[model samples]
Target: MKFKLIATFLLFATCVTAFSQEKQAQKSEKGLIKISIMYPFAEGKTFNMEYYETKHMPMVAGYLGSNLVKYTIEKGLAAGMPNQALPYMAIGTFYVKSLSDYQSAIAPNRDAIRADFANYTNVSPVILVSEVVK
Candidate 1:
């Protein structure tokens, strides 16, 4: 009985490892890449609401290797108060075939975006890369 139990446990462990490997393989095959862009609103300056909503979004869409999956702009909960931080922000998520593809898409247009927002004060975008694991 003990031997049988040990054998069963071993089989279960092996199957679990195999299943994990299969899932990893499937994710690799899909070649999905995720990028997040976070922007914090600058103090005493009006955020470029119109340009972001219209121009920036459309420009991102026009990139060859990536697709804009999600875009969100939210007011900072900590808005104006004494010693309080700024209160407006935006976040954008982009999806692409691979990390290399995403890099390639943005490299050529990097200067364009910077120049477009040159007049804007306190415009900062944080970018994050991610892979879906399920």
Candidate 2:
């Protein structure tokens, strides 16, 4: 019984150490680029949320890497706010080693992302760029 307790404690300690290392590694990364997307749906038209989830979002995730963080808001929930004109919106953060790294990674694929929007009708998207301040 005593041997089993020691073994369990060792296993728990090993797991905790591994988790701590991962969190530290994430914290050490620098140069984050934030991409905010705002869109509005026209009357009598519905936004294709599935296409964005399965297709466009995955593409953006692939380009932005595993550290990307995304946030989204829907129409009714966003109504009557100051920026209520935008019914749908998404914010994505990309973490990189440097600003040059961010620029180099996104430059070539920029046009492709812009052109892909034509496939979706009734949704007008506006993208804004920002840097992580803190």
Each candidate's number of clashing pairs is 1, 0
After the best TM-score superposition of candidate 2, give how far the Cα of residue 123 lies from its true spot, in angstroms: 3.4
Query: What would the TM-score be for candidate 2 when compared with the true structure?
Result: 0.52
TM-score on alpha carbons, each prediction: 0.56, 0.52
Best by TM-score: 1
lDDT of 1 by residue, 23-116 (tens): 8767664546667676776655555667776777667657743344434444445656877765447666666666776677788998987776
Distance from true position, residue 113, model 2, in Å? Answer: 1.6
Residues 7-99 of candidate 2 have per-residue lDDT tens digits of: 999999999999998877566542356565667544665555667666765775677554454434343345556865545543333444454
lDDT values, one for every candidate: 0.66, 0.60
Task: Indicate the worst ten consecutive residues by lDDT in candidate 1.
Answer: 65-74
Candidate 2 lDDT for residue 85: 58
Instruction: Enumerate residue pairs that collide in model 2.
Output: none
Alpha-carbon deviation at 2 in model 1, angstroms: 58
